[model samples]
Target chain A: MVKGKTLTYGVLLGSICLIGAGIYRNEVNIVLKKAVNLCLECIGIG
Target chain B: MDKRILTQIIATIAMNGNIKGFFEGSIFKGNSKKLCVPGLNCYSCPGALGSCPIGSLQAVIGSIKYNFSFYIIGFMSLMGILFGRLICGWICPFGFIQDLLYKIPLPKIKVNKKANNYLKYLKYVILLVFVILLPMFLVNDVGMSDPYFCKYICPAGTLEGGIPLVLMNESLRDTIGFLFAWKITLLIITIIFSILIYRPFCRYICPLGAFYSLFNPISFYQFKVDKNQCTMCNSCSKKCKMNIEVYKNPNSMECIRCGDCAQICPTKAITKNFSTKNL
Candidate 1:
């Protein structure tokens, strides 16, 4: 049971690390670029 | 009237607070658009303040420059790990819409248990295929790919973003074609199904729900069933819209953590968040 909890927290920490790496890589900029523009496809107008 | 309903309402309003955008037929261009919302709210919804994680993930994955999105995946994983499908129960605008649809004074159709078990796996397939595989592998001439799930399947996008945007903009209305018609058809089908079945989309269609379900057993927020207090009366199971035997599996993947089971447990056997119960 302790092992399972450890694994869960391990994954959580790993996810946070990934988020940090993504931010460093300017991936959030990609999201902002796509989001700021009107996505015609998303609205089914394309 | 319940806390859950209040939370859902507040989440919807807080996430889509740009009311002027709706009136002006424009999308919000705020800094918050860079952040992904935990639940499936369409970013193109005129009033949306944050990006939909699934949509943002697809946007990043489908882009020619980026094959994957560590940020979106990490954000979604963090949300899943912390709350599981409590986001679905208490925050998702689309889920709230389905819940409202199901409340209409119409006869409900309970799916057969044998078929339901198999049907629940479909969303996982959608997450893998439409959201992940197709976008990553199937590219246009320029090596960019479409957000296939958002473009083709997501009824939430159509209902919340597509219809409203098109209605508000004459230029957009002129651009509508078979794809728009098809999306509207899907939206209609989803609405009808929501009335007949409790959260058919969340149960069998939402990729976000499928992704969150993966962490339900291990999430920080969890349900605890006290074996000592339980009466085996199955009141929790009876109250569960997800058809989970709460006493047997308090942390089932299908559980949205709606707290109905905790509320209905006659012996007060069920508890949420932190508990000393073994399972």
Candidate 2:
């Protein structure tokens, strides 16, 4: 039962992610690019 | 007894700005200083003398308003490595509020034991996807301000940080929009839930707590278990608000080092030792 609950939660969280991605694809990409740049900048390469 | 006093003293020092000028909001001149402090204390909070590192990190990476802040990360790492989750348990003003809230007379609900273990991982997901990854990638520039945690989550930021700042700053009040209202709504929900649940944010949401848990096993301050004095009565687990089995795993990720287990140990087996030997 516990394993089942965990699986359910995993599916639910995954679905949320998928939906979020579908709705916010461009926004997510913009954020991701900025994040990558920040990380690179942190290492003094950006 | 002395430990609580020490914790209180440390909290006082951090709050009152006695030891260093940094604690009094004097460190970073610009907005970058606002992006540090791993704990949830909001930088804009009237009482907060220091910065909220998570908020700052998100803002630096997420918004089109700021630049990347190396100083914030450096400051946060210094605190994280030095005391780890100790701040979450002791120093954080928001943590203090939750501790006070749990004192109210109510029927406390513990998460189902079997399902509880999995809940510990949620904070890590929040840390990765929301706190770190999202801000870094979502912004127009590498150093733009996002405050992603505050915008999407972070009841503390909403309550202690956001509300007060907006109230005090007329300029912020004038610019309030749908996003601010959304955050305020999240804040209200969290506040209401916190009154009934014991450290709800710490248990299931805080990204900072997730970071600190990674260091718990190796952090200088740790809970030591003496197996010889074994009476597996489960009393310690019962006393825990975080719903962790203290005897089974005293240093478990969910263990907030609130000292309930140490205080209730019938055999006096649990001890919180602040030494690098464990590391």
Candidate 3:
């Protein structure tokens, strides 16, 4: 049970860390650029 | 007052777009829009100070040139691990709207467990198809793809961003077409269902909810049923708004950690936060 619990926690946390590290390599800026747009088509206005 | 009310107020205010632009029906174009809020808020909502995570995710995935969003995935992963679908119960603007709508006096719709289980799978399908596959594969000549979920579904965006924009701007009114009409129909149906059912969207259509549900069992902040104290009288299960059998599965993906079961538990058998009960 302890091993199972540890494995779950470890994998989840590890993936989070890996993804977190990748964010600095331009993922945030790219998302931010898109987000700043009104995305008129998204709300069916365009 | 409920903690939910307080969180709702804070989230609303925090996400509230610029008041002048909001009243003028202009979506915020500020740098703050770059940030993603944890819950399902529409970025184009005139009052929205931050971006919707799902919208941001779709936009990133649907970009002409694919750029996987490490930032969004990481942020959401962290949130899921920390709180799971408690974000639905406590922080989501759309979920708050549903909660208020459900509180209105109306005949309710209660699906049987078997049907409910089947419906729960819909959101996962939406996540898989609309958010992921459609955007990833169905690209235009320029390689950009539509954020299909936002374009076709997501009543939240229609409610928060669509109706307001049309009401506030004469020019945008002319832009409304079959797509807008379709979204309006979806929005109206969602609102009516919310009044008659407990979070119908959360239970069956919200891809974001589906994403968070995946982490409910192992999430750090959720509830557990104390086997010692639980007498299996079914009081907690009855109190659940999400229709979960709390005693049988305190950590069920459907359990939103709303604390209703905890408040009503006859033997005080429910406890919140991390614990060995999950193990």
lDDT of each: 0.90, 0.61, 0.83
DockQ of 2: 0.03
Q: Give the residue spans of candidate 3 off by over 4 A.
A: A18-22, B274-278
What lDDT is reached at residue B214 by model 3? 89
- Rank ordering of all candidates by lDDT, starting from the highest: 1, 3, 2
Proportion of native contacts kept per candidate: 0.75, 0.00, 0.53
In candidate 2, stretches whose alpha carbon ends up further than 4 angstroms from where it belongs are A1-46, B1-13, B16-35, B62-75, B141-145
Clash total of candidate 3: 4
Task: Give the 10-residue window scoring lowest on summed lDDT in candidate 1 chain B.
Answer: B270-279
TM-score of each: 0.98, 0.73, 0.95
lDDT of 1 by residue, B1-279 (tens): 789989999999999999988888889998999899988999999989999999998998998888888998899999988888899999999999999999999999988899999999999999999999998999999888999999999999998899889989888989999999999999999999999999999999999999999988888888998899999999998888889999999999999999988888888999897422332
Candidate 3 chain B: worst 10 consecutive residues by lDDT?
Answer: B64-73
State the RMSD for candidate 3: 1.7
Strongest candidate by TM-score: 1
Off by over 4 Å in 1: B274-279
Tell me, by lDDT, which candidate is best.
1
**CAPRI grade, predicted model 1:** medium
Report the C-alpha lDDT of model 3 over B91-164, residue by residue, as the tens digit.
89999999999999878988788999899999999999998888888888988888899999999989888988
DockQ of each: 0.74, 0.03, 0.57
Candidate 2 lDDT score relative to the true structure: 0.61
